[model samples]
Target: MSTLSTSLFYGGLGILVVGLLLPGWDTATLPRRAVKRRIYWGATLVALPVLFAAGWPDVQSSLAFTAMACVLMGGWAYFRTPNIKVGGRIITADPSHREPDPTPRGGGRP
Candidate 1:
């Protein structure tokens, strides 16, 4: 249990780092960047506390409260962030849809 929790904690930590670093990335456009930011940050918010709880059982109760707080806050922010367009696709709360085809129209398979 400890080993698994430790691994998860590190994984969540990596996600948090990626979330923190995304704003510095320059290539993504505004909409794509915003969507990515929300995703990584939201995941970090929800994952970190759970991992921490597992890794530190002595503080599990406190971490559980922290996790609930994170869930409420993260969920609110996740839904509140406005949808954005990346190329032709509108990225909404559900981003699982297929990405916009990157090829310029009338340019892909001729």
Candidate 2:
């Protein structure tokens, strides 16, 4: 890879890694960000892969990008979806069933 392509690839990777490694990146445990925000991230990350795929030789370069896409999409999904999703739809606004429950539940007590 030429210096330019190398820089671009690493730059993209760095951007993705920084975004993913943020304090709350443990997607399974994170609260949903705004759907619009997720859309932006999803579009962005997905686009990056295509861009990188064009410049790089590996197909796996897109994996992280796709994973991030999933995370953002997931956030979008959970935005209004209460936790404990039953069947295939959101049925409750119980608040407690939501993610990142604002008030931390006491361990195995609450």
Candidate 3:
């Protein structure tokens, strides 16, 4: 029971941390950044006390769970980051419905 709750708390924490550190999150405008800043800080303020209150009775499991969560979430998020190659040319090929004729129409078998 305790392990489950601790694991859930840790998992949520892991997701939040990975989302914070992941690139492209800060690509917002000033107003949008301000709103997100507020929300991020606001969630931290609200969550810490609640988590402390819940985990204070079982410190060991909470810490261990949080550690495992960090490792798992961090690795997952790392691999999921955009793999754009700088200065690389991107070619999008359109699939042809019909194959091209083997020989040209007028110039064939002349």
Query: In angstroms, what RMSD does candidate 3 have relative to the true structure?
Result: 17.0
TM-score of each: 0.37, 0.34, 0.34
* Model 2 regions lying over 4 Å from their true place: 24-110
Q: Which residue pairs collide in model 1, if any?
A: none
Best by TM-score: 1
State each model's CA lDDT, in order.
Answer: 0.53, 0.47, 0.43
List the candidate 3 regions with Cα displacement exceeding 4 Å.
11-15, 18-30, 58-110
Per-residue error (Å), model 2, residue 50: 8.5
The best-first sequence of candidates by TM-score reads 1, 2, 3
Candidate 3 per-residue lDDT, tens place, 34-64, comes to: 3343444444444454445445567875565
Error of 3 at 49 (Å): 2.2
Write one digit per residue (lDDT tens) for candidate 1, span 7-85.
Answer: 7666765665565455522233334444565666666666666556655766764476457546744564445433244
Candidate 2, residue 26: the lDDT equals: 19
Clashes of 1: 0
Task: Enumerate residue pairs that collide in model 3.
Answer: none
lDDT of 3 at 20: 55
Per-residue lDDT of model 2, residues 1-110, tens digit only: 56765676566655554444433311333334332234445445655754455365555654554565566545644553343244534434455444433322222210
Give residue 52's lDDT in candidate 3 (0 to 100): 50
* TM-score of candidate 3 versus the correct structure, residues matched by position: 0.34
